[model samples]
Target: MKIILSNASSDPIYIQIVNQIRQSILSGELRAGDSLPSIRQLAKDLQVSVITTKRAYEELEKEKLIDSVVGKGCFVSGANKDFIREQRMTRLEEKMVEIIRESKELSMSKQDVLDYLNLLYEEEHTP
Candidate 1:
């Protein structure tokens, strides 16, 4: 998997790493039981501090998305895809609730939000 970092992004470096690695696993690009680069190796490759990579790995481990073995290195968790997807969906639902509340505060109608969502969804899907 290739990880690209963006200096212009608002998110911290570790977050960017975590997000991309999470996407890889979720998309099946990195399948269950697939071995990931070692923390030191990834740190050297990304030209980032070891702490950054460790933090990113720690976050993934916290989500049960990956597992680390003392000597073997980190690998994608063996959890079923449906379970992983459900975990992400739960998080998405929570975020949507916050967004919906904000939309209501701004007097944005349901249709308005739906239209905007449709546009955004289409934009993401468009080639």
Candidate 2:
């Protein structure tokens, strides 16, 4: 797993770590049972405090995205991919609902939102 941290981000260091690892797992870049670097090792590699990585791992463990075994370090949990996808879809729907409500308040039409979204999608996908 590759994790990059940005000092410019508003989120805390631990949250940045958590989000990147979570995305990797959800995207299948980190398969179930894939071993993670030890907390001390990751901290050394990232040049961050061990506490930061530990907190991030703890958060992932709480979400059941990864597991920790005594003396064995951490590994991705064998979670159901369909369940994960469904959870992500539900969150996306909630966000879209809020976006739609805000767009209506701003007098924006569906076409306006679609155009903006398409532009963003293209920008992200552009080489």
Candidate 3:
């Protein structure tokens, strides 16, 4: 597991850590039962306080993306399909909102924007 922190980001260090780990889980990079680094190790690797790393891990546990085992370590949780679908939809809606705003500013027709979307989607999915 790799995490990169940005000192320039407006978000706190813990939030940045949580977001990256969440994204990894959602993207399937971190699968169910995959072991995560210990809080102390993560703090050392990221050069942040142990408290910050613990906070990030706690948030992940709260979201059901990870679980902590006593005397062991944290591991990725088996995510619920419905919850995953909801998260995907939420992210898609956010992107669509941005696309719609940009299209309106450019005076593009709805169909034009949709056609571009389809093209981009196909490009990404093509082998």
Candidate 4:
């Protein structure tokens, strides 16, 4: 699994890690049963506090998105694909609503928002 940190972002570090990992699982980049990096190793690699990574992992476990085995490590849960997809879409819609509200606060017109979104889509899909 791959994770990137954004010190400049308003979101907490642990939340960023959790959301990215969750996205990976939903996108099929991290398959069910795939083992995750140990907390200490991920902390070292991400240069974050062990507590932060641990909290993120614990939250994921609580959500049943991942399972921790004693002596073995944390692995992605064998969750149903349809369920995961629905959950992912719901989260995406919530975030999109937040973005739309922010755009409205900035007084962006509908056309402007659409153009900006198209630009974002192109950027994300760019090779």
Identify the candidate with maximal TM-score.
1
Kindly list the per-residue Cα lDDT of model 1 for residues 24-45, writing each as its tens digit. 9999899988999999999999
Q: Worst lDDT window (10 residues) for model 4?
A: 79-88
Q: Model 4 misses residue 3 by how many Å?
A: 3.2
Q: Which stretches of candidate 2 lie over 4 Å from their true place?
A: none
Per-residue C-alpha lDDT of model 4 across residues 50-100, encoded as one tens digit per residue:
999999999888767899998999999998878777876897899999989
Residue 12 lDDT in candidate 2: 99
Instruction: Tell me the number of clashing residue pairs for each predicted model.
Output: 0, 0, 0, 0
lDDT of each: 0.96, 0.94, 0.92, 0.91
The RMSD (Cα, Å) of candidate 4 is 2.9
Q: Point out the worst 10-residue segment of candidate 3 by lDDT.
A: 79-88
Q: Against the true structure, candidate 3 has what lDDT?
A: 0.92
Clashing pairs in 4: none
Query: lDDT by residue for model 3 over 13-67, one digit each (tens)?
Result: 9999999998888888999999999999999999999999999999899878899
**lDDT of candidate 3 at residue 38, scale 0 to 100:** 97
Q: What is the per-residue lDDT of model 2 for residues 1-127, given as tens digits with 9 covering 90 to 100?
A: 7899999999999999998998999888999999999999999999999999999999999878999999999999998888777877897999999999999999999999999999999999999
